[model samples]
Target: MKKVSVIVPAYNAHDTLARCLGSLVNQTLQDIEIIVVNDASTDDTWEIMSRCEKQFPDKVIIIDGDRNRGAGGARNQALDLASGEYIGLVDSDDYVAPRMYELLYEKAKEGDYDIVDSGYYQEATDTARLYTGDDLTGILDDNKRKKTYCRRRISCYQSF
Candidate 1:
């Protein structure tokens, strides 16, 4: 079985799709499978996915949807087909560090965590921010931590 199954939901993201897939294919964690879901893209996204499928036949799985499903729907579809021990969600417009999954998987195995989350950097601003969880107490005071935690936003990546 694959160690990780990364789900990529793509719409009209032809411009960034290649960069995103490139990052995944070059990950330090080689024992991973990338499931790319084309959510009825009107552009050449499907073609790019097709090429990736051919280029990395063993590592890439392409799923073409007949109708336009949103990103969440695409992720749901890929989730059903996932065969790895851990599931990862990524957007076609975003890419991760080469060692991101490798490090996350290692930490998860070491701690036997049910779910693991991490900080992300915005592509436009290059700012790294962490999610508010049990670890917040170490970084902020009680009152401030509570306020920051309450304003949590959905992040782009997760591993389980």
Candidate 2:
């Protein structure tokens, strides 16, 4: 089984999907699985996912949606197919750092926590700003049965 399942519900996100996927496949946590759901996109989102799967056969899983399921529905489908000990949901139009999953996973293993998450940067045309700053390390010892969040100033990893 995969260590982490990264789910992406994409709908006509051809313009940014490539970069979002690029970050996933290149993650430092190589034991992760990437689930890319097409969500019936009219654009070439499927084509991009196809190429990604071809390039990373053991890492990328592509789902072709017959109907236009909204983001949450698409995520449910991918979640059902996921075979990971942990899961990460990402937007198709958003990209993450290479070490994003690695940091979160390591923290989860260290604390034996349920849900770990991190903060991300909001990209603007002229500038990028820090958002969701939470220091996940502070709450590492929280109940393993409950969700945990980490926020910090830097954008590397929080708790996810």
Model 2 segments more than 4 A misplaced = 125-160
Q: Candidate 1's residue-wise lDDT over 1-160, tens digit each? A: 8989999999998899999999999999999999999999999999999999999998999999988889989999899889888998888988889999999999878877656667788767777777546644333568765665576554556666
- The true-versus-predicted C-alpha distance at residue 4 of model 1, in Å, is 0.4
TM-score per prediction, in order, is: 0.86, 0.81
Note the Cα lDDT for every prediction shown.
Answer: 0.86, 0.81
Clashes of each: 0, 11
Candidate 1 — which residues are off by over 4 angstroms?
A: 132-151, 154-156
Model 2 Cα lDDT, one tens digit per residue, 1-160: 9889999999999799999999899999989999999999999999999999999999999999999989889999998899989988888887788888998899889978777766567555444445433433454446422333232333222323
Could you say which candidate leads in TM-score?
1
